[model samples]
Target chain A: MVSKELKVTTEAGIHARPAAAVVETCSRFQSRISFIKGDIRANAKSIMNIMLLAAEYGADILVEAEGPDEAEALGAVERLFAEKFRQE
Target chain B: MDGSSPRKVLRGIPVSSGIAIGPAYLFHPQKREISRHPVAPENVEQEVARLKRALERARKDIQGIRDRIAGAVGEYEARIFDSHVLILRDEEIMGTIYSDIRENLNNAEYAFYRRMNQISDRFDQAAGGFLKEHLIDLRDVASRVIDILTLSDGGKDAPEIHHPVVLLARTVTPSELAQFTTGNTLGICLETGGKTSHVAILARSLEIPAVSGIPWKELSLEPGQMVIVDGNAGQVILNPSLRDIKEHEGRRAAHWAHEQDLAGLRDIEPVTSDGKYISLAANVELPLEVESVLRHGADGVGLYRSEFLFLGREDMPSEEEQYQAYRHLAHHLAPRHVTIRTLDAGGDKPVPALQVDDERDPMGWRSIRVSLRNPAIFKVQLRAILRASAAGNVRLMFPMISNLQEFREAKRLTEQAREELRAQGLPFDENLEIGCMIEVPSAVLMAKEIAREADFFSIGTNDLAQFTLAVDRSNERVSDLYEPHSPAVLRQIQMVVEAARSQGIPVGVCGEMAADPYLALLFIGMGVDELSMSPGGLLEMKRMTRAISYEDARRSAREALRLGTATEIHQWLEDKFRDLFVRLGLRRGTGAG
Candidate 1:
């Protein structure tokens, strides 16, 4: 398992679109991923779960993944957010 | 007979919904023409019976629409109609008209008009302007009643647009479109409406190509012929051949694909080909729109308009109610920064709960100014925002700020609010980032002094451009003067960006300019740290941001700043990025291309 705190640079934190992307990204991996905001932890698969966090621009969130593909999951999630939500 | 002239298809801006390709079913409501009553023949009681039956049918029809909307739009929102219904059903109103029609031996129409005069007279007796406007929505209610009374649905027999037709009208209402069906629809054209109008909203939602603002008489259209609607381009072609239809269908497909392409951008990181990151967020009006912002892949809500809570309500929202609204959003956007502006009402937007003076001079007596004048309302909002700050990450913004003094006053008030919470033993975010909107030209000119006293600056370009040019964007005659590309407006925006950058304060543009794909480059070039707008524009902006490099943006900004006139700046951008400009679909020669 690989885990680290990532700053949400996308102006809006885990908004539905990006959450959908994250969920899409997580589902692609054999690994299970989760996002933690303070005491609340939401399954990365659920867009509703992530939006409930109400994370705004520049908010730091905890990202964790467990699987052989955990490294890929972490790198993908971190890059998606750090890139500031520009849909390419 | 010269029967071969071909149909002249007219193009117009569509402002309402449901594409009706039927022969222009125009119902232009006007003041009823009055005529001297001629003595009627015997059996006038039967005439009264006919009028009563139609009135009852109209009442039933309104009730049916009300019930359907209640069921469709959800019971809560349909509640707004409950007031209209009570006004419709009030026995006092019916009894007055019913008695006059029977006892006075007056015609039903005359009795109705007389009853309307009484209501108007009563409203005229009232003092407040707001009250008068509400009554004014009723001013034409009698006319509507009359129109419904006279409506025979004539010539609506068989499906109107069998082959193809270009529907043109002065203006269409939501009620008119509610009865429209897809089998009879092709495209819609209206003489009025823009992006915010119901026509545009419904057209976009229904995936129909509709345009508004074209005078119907300008085009000579024939019946039972083909036409094409290039709504995105705001163009229409009349009596199109099969070849033209094929071309138009292709264009429609591409437009739909472009929309889908933007939707596809929902999950993509807004990184450029060169990979410089820019923050993208949405300016939200309600929590329900949060789904759209999320769908657009915005980082989070950057600006949540708090004015809507006060709208249509007689009393101010309770502190707990305000707190709950903010708390729900803040908690929902946990870890994301939801920078909510303090009630942006007042100025042009009036809320009766505040009872602000309806002065000829509303400039200074607006926004945070009004809130500050009435601390009771200001404290209710401040406490709510302050309370919600703890749920997750939230930032507070003050609007229409002109000088450092206003900033100081607002800061002191926010501090007092925080102190009240502490005294009450309530938890709150200890470190809250406070910002002010640079909407006024004076605020932009004095951005440095204000930035020194503030944590951040969000430029409200809608007002800034309008104020700078002294042009009301709402006024169609002079809206052309209200251009973001204007050298003067661009400079003001640049000045704020530079001032904030020099002072090390975070800055953003929270105006329609932030949403325009064509100007996104200019904003980045000007060095704004963030761009905020309606969630509807977020994904498209995200896609545009990822396509352009910051270096190019900065270069464009510098070049645009040196221009002399608004036209000159626009021309320069056009000449510079003629190809890219064309791709962006910005109008050439004028603002609306």
Candidate 2:
């Protein structure tokens, strides 16, 4: 299992587009990816689950992946967060 | 032809004048009654397989729409559909639905519907409803899946019109109305909507006969029933007798001939016999109506209700979407002004995305007030309008501006939008004219103050009459009291026109009154510069403008202004113009006249 803590830096936070980017990145790998914000855990592969988190700007979310390509999945998710979901 | 069946006649308000004799097509787009039934044990696997197939088909459907939107609009807009596709492919939802069918023996549609409602409830209870927008998206995706499931089970889908038919609906949004091919839709009958509603405007521009205000519950109509829509008489007849059919058939021919005669007046200027000119324009809702406006030789578009772009959709329109629509209008109607009214989403026009809860209150938080409260949304619209101004002649008008403060705030936001565009190096027209609607009585009282800052004014007589009389026009009990020709309404209009004159700004009337020959003559006599209405009324108004002398109209207007009551004014105008109206064919000539 690979785990990483990421901060939502985008202005509007992880909205529909950013959440979609997270799900798209997570779906590519054969891994079980989940995002934990405080007490709630969201399946990163499901866009609705990620959107339900309602992680606003500056909120911290912990991402966890477990499976064959767990390392690559975690890395890709971290990169998405680092780039602020590729939003200007 | 149907002598055995009794004929039923229904009365409504004639919005677009013509005649249509065809079969009825009842349009019920969003019927949300989900049937819940148990599946047999032997049919469990079959039901699960059906659910899977539906999911796959829904995914493909959304993907097709995404690709098309990406090609037509932009990637930003198409990206929203990507989330819809993902929701369709979500294994969590699909696995739950499959299990519901296998274990609970529930039908596929009910299983999916139950799970989606559960998910929607969860989103609704989310922290402070921040996920409200996402809830809308979720419902959108769920409805698409449900629609597919229902279709496969021989349920209702969007009715496909292969032959000419008169569409019957309780009310239809512009997008829903756009689904049917223009050639197939011979006319339209609605249970709701006023003479100036978006559907009425679209029907007129398309040259489709339409009537509204008929009660839907009273229509007990079957699909493909023979119906005659007499738009000239504001009447619909179902299962007509042979003689009734023959009479309507003859009238239809005469109506067509009359329309052809009116077509000849298109190229002529709308100048009075006294050589006084009145600018005749069209009030358009959709970009598709621009062709009709030009074909009818309108001076310009006086009231381009921009809220149609926001209606019939789950989400608010993006800046790019709004920009493209406004730009299309400005580009096509270059040198002819397009007065785009900013989001008038409340009262009769309810926009769900704007969260306007009190739609019944016309004086509540709506129009300019709604825009002022939500600067983010307002700025996007302002910026788009400004961007389109660079393409051609575009003017911005604010609706429901009751006070000088509201007008100033709207103007400030518009200026802010201009500055933002300037910073981004986007070109816009610095001299773009800004106008305010004189709808409420307060606006009329403060017209002189608002006129100093506003470049122009448009009097929305429908709201003005309702507000001035404190009578809801839709309310049957008080509708009779809501008179546009009331002396109080005319005096207020005179005040607004005089205020505009004092400020050296032009004032126009863009309301139903502008289409009435008598009221239009009063407005012209009051020194109103422009009269805009539905395109169907443009040629008729032009004909009226040419027949009467401006001196006579002005003198009659002055004499009628001193009338004591609405009945007196109405009676005097009717008596004074009876001979001229009949001579000019403005009114039907009875032998007594």
Candidate 3:
């Protein structure tokens, strides 16, 4: 299992577009990925769950992945956050 | 009450003039009813499978829509569907739904509905409603799945009308109305909208009887119940008595007989008794109207509202699509001039591709302004019209041109289109006539300057009267102030005619005012060279033209301009023409009158 804490750096935060990006990226790996925001845990592959978290700009989210490809899944999620979901 | 259902009469605003009696087809596609029933314990697996099938179908539906949006609009607008597909594929949500049906023995629809409601409630309370917009996407997906589960033949939005029926709805979009053009829709009744609405205009153009503004709750009708739409009187009769039907049938016969009588004047030239010839033309929206225009024997199409091609669709039409439509009209009506108006979108007629900002002022950022700002889109249409010019006698016109600069900008882009076509080795008319609509007050004021640079003018009196009087005709409070017979509006028309005459160019009135016999007489007297109206009004206007001498019409119109108020002018013209109109069967007489 691997876990990493990342901050949402986009101005609009994790809205529909970014949430979609997270789900699309997380679905590519054979790992169980989930995002933890405060007390709520959201499945990274479900856009509805990620949107329900409503992680605003500057909010910290912990991504936890568990599987044989956990390290690769965590790296991909971390890269999405660093790139602000490629939204510019 | 004589061995028939009790009669109930409802009054509304009459938009299209006709009478139709048929079964009622109540259309409320959005307000679908979902009833919950328990699933048998043995059938639990089958119910779960059904849920999965619906979700898969919905996912495919969203995918198709996403592709179409990406093709028609852009990638940015299509990205929202990506999230929708994710929501449809969310196993966490589907697992809960699957367990609900298995554990609680609930039907697939109820199980899915309950789970969606819980998710919706969570979305409502999340981040103080920051995710409310996402909630709409969630509901959109949920409805698609639910509609598929409920409807047997998949989920088609438009209802199929195999027999003659009067369509009743809350409000109908232009696209929704177009689907009913199969001729099975005998009439239309709406809970809202007025005479000038796009739907009303379409209904009138298609010759369908329509009455609007009837409250939906008051229309308590059963499926296929007998109803009467008396569009001439703006009344709807539900469960109409046998006697009432008989009376309306009589009136319908008389109306058809009157129409047949006017059909004899189709080929006659619209020359006044004083030897002055006037051109009569038709204002068409769809290419389908070309056949009607020809049947009515119009000299040509004076106002082809091209914006309608953009309506009822999500994506902007490609240049090829527009070129095909324009070429169809030009090719079919060869030698007869076909004037295609550029996109006049915004303010009442909203195009999704344009994405106009929601402005409180309807006149702001609409019409030519929208076209000027979006040159890429404007140029595509210009190129299409230019390409079609080679097929026949095609003319291009711009709408709502406020000044010479705007007209000049439009003309420059048209020239650019022409140059591009020429460079591509394409053929088009070198001397294609270009015109500008004299609709706005400022355009009327600058008519002389605009005329010098343009080939012709067409007066759009609906907007002219609305703008000149500062009345929003759609607003009920000020609609009464929107008087086309007002002295101010009449003088503006005269000014545009004078400007066109000075420049040695022809001018025409292509608005609703031109369809009125009295107003047509006034326009002829003012020396307007042409009059354009709906196809249905052509033969009648031609009859009126052939009955009067231009010298007499000119003198009456001159006398009318001197009148003080709109009422005085209207009353004076009515008195002078009332006898003539009654003699010509244009007006109903009360025997004593």
- Number of clashing residue pairs in every model? 33, 0, 0
Residues B1-593, model 1: lDDT tens digits:
22355645554543322223333333232234222232254535654665566566656665675576665445544443433444444444656676766677666666666776666555544333213433433544455555555554221122233443445455554334433424354566677767654445444434445777777565455443445666656666665556766776676666556667768788888776677777788877655555566777888777787876775433568899889888888887777788989997664445645654233233656688888788766988999999999898889999998888988898899999999999999988988899989999989889988988888889988788888988866677976777788888888888898899888998988876776665777888888888887665666577667767888888888887887887787777767766764565433222332
Off by over 4 Å in 1: A1-88, B1-96, B99-231, B235-252, B356-364, B581-593
- Residue B432's lDDT within candidate 3 is 96
**Each prediction's Cα lDDT score?**
0.67, 0.85, 0.86
* Global local distance difference test of model 3: 0.86
**Worst window of 10 by summed lDDT in candidate 3 chain B:** B584-593
Ranking by DockQ: 3, 2, 1
Report clash pairs, candidate 2.
Answer: none
Better of 1 and 2 by DockQ: 2
- Across B116-221, the per-residue lDDT of candidate 2 in tens digits comes to 8888877778775667768767877887888787876445332345689888887876777876646898888899887767678678878898899888776676
- Local error of candidate 2 at B584, Å? 1.8
Stretches of candidate 2 off by over 4 Å are A1-88, B1-7, B29-158, B194-198, B217-221, B587-593
> Distance from true position, residue B568, model 1, in Å?
1.6
**Best lDDT goes to which candidate?**
3
Q: List residue ranges in candidate 3 displaced over 4 A.
A: A1-88, B1-6, B29-159, B357-360, B587-593
